[model samples]
Target: MRQSSLTGGAIMFTGYLLFFIIMRALGLLEVVELRAINFIFLIAGVYTAISLEKKHLGWGFTYFQGLGAGIEATVLGVMPFAVFIFVYLSWIDPEFMVYIREHEPLGHYITPFMAAFVIVIEGCASGFISAYTIMQYVKAHTAHPHE
Candidate 1:
């Protein structure tokens, strides 16, 4: 279970990073604002966590248990994402503020609290979705066990 969780968390982080990079290259990264991303994470994370927990524990979902798992996965995913975002914002785009201020009207007024909320929501949703996907795949393969 622990191994699966770690693996799933890693997969989620990598998948999201790749997605972000692709979106950035296409100049659509901003479309996934922190808040919207976070909201998606929360919804996906809950479902994934529940599915994974049931697979490992043989029981249905519990809010506390699922939340704990979701948070753990979220933390793992965030550590790398934080560094990635910092690198992109700082070294990659020192002039990002100016561009954002001019092009993105709301960029200057975005608060730290808002960013935090978005990150939290993103982490939760990503974690859950990853977990759910992992479980589904595992179950499908197991059901059609190879000789």
Candidate 2:
């Protein structure tokens, strides 16, 4: 909704795309375990957005503001990445889809849309959690308006 959140989301999106491309280039895209590392990028991006918003608001920063910025950044960052994944699996390389399907619990039920949808859900939850946790430290250091 705000510039800081948008910028943070952009950073997260860029990192997600770049990392995926790098993994694909290295032929390690299939290494299921390595995907966990993407969470770090997500956390970093959310932190950046919330921190920026805090600075912008100065002593006016509030819990809700941080939460919104974090969630907005996460959604903005993840939506495009999910689309990219959907496109890649659906058109660029159906084999990857097959690979993912085979590795998933309900292998037969998995689809490109499902995969992308999962990312969206994960991103939103992660964003909320990340924001809440980060706000603990930030709120502690910040001078509350009521104070």
Candidate 3:
């Protein structure tokens, strides 16, 4: 489980990083339109991890196990990205931070720490919801005979 989670997390992190770089290179990083689209990778990562767990467990996989795996993968995967965001905002491009502060819908300035916190919180929430939703299908298909 640990191995799969770590591997899946790495995969997720890589995918996100790649997309971020691409978006930045294309000068679309600050475009709010692309933000939601990036979430597809996040969902893919969690789903991939849970699917791998299911494969490993074969016929005995359970909903809770899938949920746990998804959560673990999401946390591990998003941590690196969160750190990167902090560093990027703090050093690489403080102007982006200023832009965000100035145009934020909430009308609140976000520090680097706040940005990281929001990322983690959002990732965890997405992970939890995705895990629960995905596990419903797994649970239905893998239910035991006695149940």
Top model by lDDT, which number? 2
| CA shift of 48, model 1, Å | 3.1
Model 2 Cα RMSD, 1 decimal = 1.3
Residue-level lDDT tens digits of model 2 in 1-147: 799889889999999999999999999987888878888889888999999999999877788998889888989999999999899999999998998878878988989999999999988888789888988887788877577
Q: Which ten residues in a row have the lowest lDDT in candidate 2?
A: 138-147
lDDT on C-alpha atoms for all candidate structures: 0.55, 0.89, 0.82
Ranking of models by lDDT: 2, 3, 1
List residue ranges in candidate 2 displaced over 4 A. Answer: none
- Of the pair 1 and 2, which is ahead by TM-score? 2
Model 3: how far is 98 from its true place, Å?
Answer: 1.5
Q: Model 1 segments beyond 4 Å from truth?
A: 30-46, 59-63, 104-147
Tens digit of lDDT per residue, candidate 1, span 44-92? 4334544576467553434455446655666666656666665666567
- Model 1: weakest 10-residue lDDT segment is 138-147
Best by TM-score: 2
Q: List the residue pairs that clash in candidate 1.
A: 38-121, 38-122, 41-125, 42-125, 45-125, 45-128
Tens digit of lDDT per residue, candidate 3, span 40-124? 7777877888888988987677778888888898898889989998999899988888888888886365898899889889887
For all the candidates, what are their Cα RMSDs to the real structure?
7.1, 1.3, 1.9
